[model samples]
Target: MAGHDMLRSISRTFKLPEELFSGMPRIEINGDEEVTVENHKGILMYEDEQIQINGGNAVVQIRGRGLRLCTMTRTILTIRGYITGVEFLR
Candidate 1:
């Protein structure tokens, strides 16, 4: 197994929330207006139609109209506006 997979196994075995110890991405959506992404590596793409964020194991893509970036930090990203869809691309 890859190192990442092994880490995941260990994280699960310990009954720990992976997001705390792992770099795996965690996303929180508040209704259809706001979104918070944790452990985001970086923003790969951004536009009105779509926004792509790089995470540890997967990339998060948000689709919507009038999408706006509320804030971004080294480990977090916040988005605001009408969120039409969300997807994970591995």
Candidate 2:
């Protein structure tokens, strides 16, 4: 299993909040117009068609039209536009 998966399983077994470990990325979509991601390392690639950010074991990618950063900080990213797809790539 991936490192993050193992950490998640352990967190579950211990009855701990999954976010405690902070290895897995947390994503929240407020409708298709906005999306938020937590614990992302940084942005690797960005464009209207795609935005890729560094996560622990993989790169988190968001796809859509008129994609914009909107807002970003050390631990979180707020994106605005039509979020067509979300994925992770190694």
Candidate 3:
């Protein structure tokens, strides 16, 4: 925990994005039709109405309609559909 505290202090001092220091997921939502996730570990589930992503310390669950994996890479993922909800489970 001390290491994390030190990183947090450095981040604040440098005015850097917190996610650059914290191993946490960064999520971006574009209206109700698209979602992007960064710093994600991997996908846990994929379906027409639900998608689950492993986010290291937590899991990102997305629920929607006609869900599709638009893009995915080592650390980034993009989902497209009529997104109804998003949840983070730790």
Better model by TM-score, 2 or 3? 2
> Which portions of model 2 show Cα errors greater than 4 Å?
1-5
The top-ranked prediction according to lDDT is 3
> What's the best-to-worst order under lDDT?
3, 1, 2
Candidate 2 RMSD to the real structure: 1.7
What's the lDDT of the predicted structure labeled candidate 2?
0.88
Candidate 1 C-alpha lDDT tens digits along 1-90: 387777778889999888876677899999999999999999999997789999767889999988999899998889998999999998
Clashing pairs in 1: none
Q: For residues 1-90, what per-residue lDDT tens digits would candidate 2 score against the true structure?
A: 467788888899999988768476789999888989998889999999899988876798999999999999999999999889999897
Question: Residue 20 CA error for candidate 2 (Å)?
Answer: 2.5
Give the poorly placed runs of model 3, Cα more than 4 Å off: 1-6
RMSD to native for every prediction? Answer: 1.4, 1.7, 1.7
Backbone clashes counted, model 2:
0
lDDT of 3 by residue, 1-90 (tens): 678778878988999997789677899999999999999999999999999999877799999999999999999999999999999987
What would you estimate as the lDDT of candidate 1?
A: 0.89
Q: What residue runs in model 1 are displaced by over 4 Å at the alpha carbon?
A: none
**Best candidate, TM-score-wise?**
1
